[model samples]
Target: MVTSKVKQIHDFGQSIWLDFIDRKIIFSGELKKLIEEDGLRGVTSNPAIFEKAISSSSDYDEDIAQLSKSDKTNEEIFFSIAVEDIKLACDLLAPVYNEEGVVGADGYVSLEVSPFLALDTQATIKQARELWRQVGKENVMIKIPGTESGLIAFETAISEGINVNVTLLFSLDRYKAVAEAYISGLEKRAADGLPVDHISSVASFFLSRIDILVDPFLDQKGLGDLRGQVAIASAKTAYQIYKRMFSTDRWKKLAEKGAVPQRLLWASTSSKDPAFKDTRYIEALIGPDTVNTIPMETLQAFRDHGDPASRLEEDIDGAAGILERIKVAGIDMDAVATQLEEEGIDKFSKPFQQLLDAIERQK
Candidate 1:
C-alpha cells in the first residue's frame, strides 16, 4: 500500500495537526480515520471553528435544547457540549499521547478560553482553570491568546501543571516573550520541587496573516518580488529563536527536571492567496520539534500533492534578508503583529457570542 503524503511529513519531524473539531467528525469515525490512516496526531478548536460547527450543524441541537431547559447560561451550555467532545477525543487519542513518540509526540486537543477575556489576565486564568476541571482530561490543551496579559496567564497556568497552547502570536519579539514565559513557568515549578514532567505547552506562531498584511505594503512599494513572503520569513526566524532558547542551560536544567521544551506550533497556515500554492506554509515551515495545524481543505490539498521536506532551516541568511528588506520598505512589523492580535481576538469573540445565541435559540 502506498503511504499517504501527510504521513511523509512525519519523516521530516514536523506534525500535521487538524485545525478543526466537531461532533460529526468525532462520532462519525472521520477523526479516527485521519488519526489511523492519515497520520493526524492532534486537534485544535476555537470560538470561530466551534461557532461554525455548532451553528451550521444539527449535530449539537439536542444537547443545546436539553441544556437550554436547565438553569445553565448559554456559555455554560456551550461548554457542556464542548467539554464532552474534548473528553471523547482525548480518550481516542490517548495512545499517541502515551506513546510519547518523538514525531507524533502529543495527542493534544486544544480548547480556547473565551476570546472576550483575552486582555483580562485574571479572568483568563480563572476560566482556563475551570475549563480544565470541566474537561478533566490529561491530554487537553487550554488555548489562550498570546496577548500581553496572556503571557502572565500562561506562566501561571503552566506553573500549575495545566497544558496551554498560546495562540494568536505573530512577531519575533513577542514570540521571544512567550518562550520566556514558558521557561519561567517551568523554573517556578522546579523551584517548588513540583513534578514538571507532565506540564506541556506550545507557542502558536501565526503564519499566513503576516503576508496578508505585509504583502500589500510591499506591492504598493513596488517590491512585487517581496509579495507573499513575510509570513514564511518570520516563521523561519521564529524557529531559529526556538533553537537558541531551548538549547540554553536554563532549558537544560528544566529538562533535567522532566520539562519538555515548549514546541513552536505554526498556526493560521493556509495559503490565503489563491495565486500561491495551497501548502506553501506547510511545505516551507517543515522541520523537527514543531507543528503545523491546518484546516481540512489545506490538509487535503497537502495529502493530494504536497512535497514535504525539512526546509525551515534551509535559508537562515535569506530569511533574515527578507525581513530586513521589509524594514527598509517601511513595513512596521510590530504594528502589524499588534493589529493582528487585536483582530484575531475580535474574530473569535464575535463568533463565540453568535455561537452562544445560536445555542440559546434551540430552547
Candidate 2:
C-alpha cells in the first residue's frame, strides 16, 4: 500500500522525487518499491550524489573495471557509468512517464551536466546534447545550472528539443529569465515547425540553502525570528511569479500548440537546521505544478508524519512581507544570491573533480 502521507501529496497536485540515486537502490529494487509504495514520481542525481554512490560503494566496481580496460579517461568512464544508471532508472519509471501520455506531467529523471561547464555556454550546450544522446531516453532531463551562461545553454538545448532541469536558481529575477528562456525555446521550436509538445523543462529553485545563508545574517542583525522563514517565503513568491508568467497570452499560444509550462521544482529541500521539523519544506510547499526532490532521510520522515495540505498559495501577502523585511534588514539579497550561485557552482565542481580523481585511482 502507498504510504498515505507521501502518496497523498499527489492529491494537492505536487510530485515527490527522490534526490538521491545510486546503483544499490536501482539494483536492489528499492527505487521501484519507492515508486510503487511511496508514489515516487522521479529521480534527480548530481555530481555529489554520483561521487558518494561510486566512492562509498563497491556496486559500481565491475563497470568501472570494465570501462577502465578500454583506455577511456576517468571522466569518460564516469559518464558511461552514470549514463547506464540513468537509463536503468528511466526504464523503471517508464510506467509513470507514460502515464496518460502527458509528456510533462510526471515520471522524469534528471541527470546534471558537468558543473565545470557551468560558466561556458558553448561547452555546456555541447555536453548537454551529448549527455542527452548518451542517455537516449525521452523521460530524462539534462540538469543545467541557471547561471547566466547556463541560461543560454538551456535555451539552446530546449530549442533543439532536449529536456532541461534548470538548477541553482536563487533570485526571482533569474527565475524570470529562466521562464523567459523556456518560452523563447518553445517559440523557436514552434516557429521552426518542430514538435513543441515533446520538449519538457523544470526551473529548480533551491530552498533550504536560502535560509541557511540568510539565517546567520538574520541572527547577526538580531532578527532571529526570521531564521527559518526566508526560503519558504521566497518559494511562495516564486509560485506567484509562475502563475503570472504562465497565464500570459504568450504562454497561451504555446499551450494551444501543446507546450506545457516549465513547472517549478523545489530543490535543496531538506531542512539544514535541526530545530526545524524534518518535513518542514515538503509539508509547506505542496501545491499544483511543483516538485520537491528530497533526500532519503527526509522522505522517510515525511512518510511517517506528514500532514498534507494546500498551503503553497496561503499567506501570499505574508510571503511578500517576509521578503520585504529581510530586504529592509540590509542583507543584500541579490548579492546573497550571487554568492550562493558561485558557491553552488564550486560545491558541485569540487565533488565532480573528486569523483573523477576517485575513478582515476580505480583505473
- Candidate 2: list runs displaced more than 4 Å: 1-3
Pairs with steric clashes in candidate 2? none
Find the candidate with the highest lDDT and give its number: 2
Model 1: clashing residue pairs?
none
lDDT of 1 by residue, 175-245 (tens): 99999999998889888989988888889999888888888889898888988888888999999999999
- Listed per candidate, the RMSD to the true structure in angstroms reads 1.2, 1.0
| Per-candidate local distance difference test | 0.90, 0.93
Error of 1 at 102 (Å): 5.3
* Model 1 misplacement above 4 A: 100-104
lDDT at position 31, candidate 1: 94
TM-score of every model?
Answer: 0.98, 0.98
TM-score of 2: 0.98
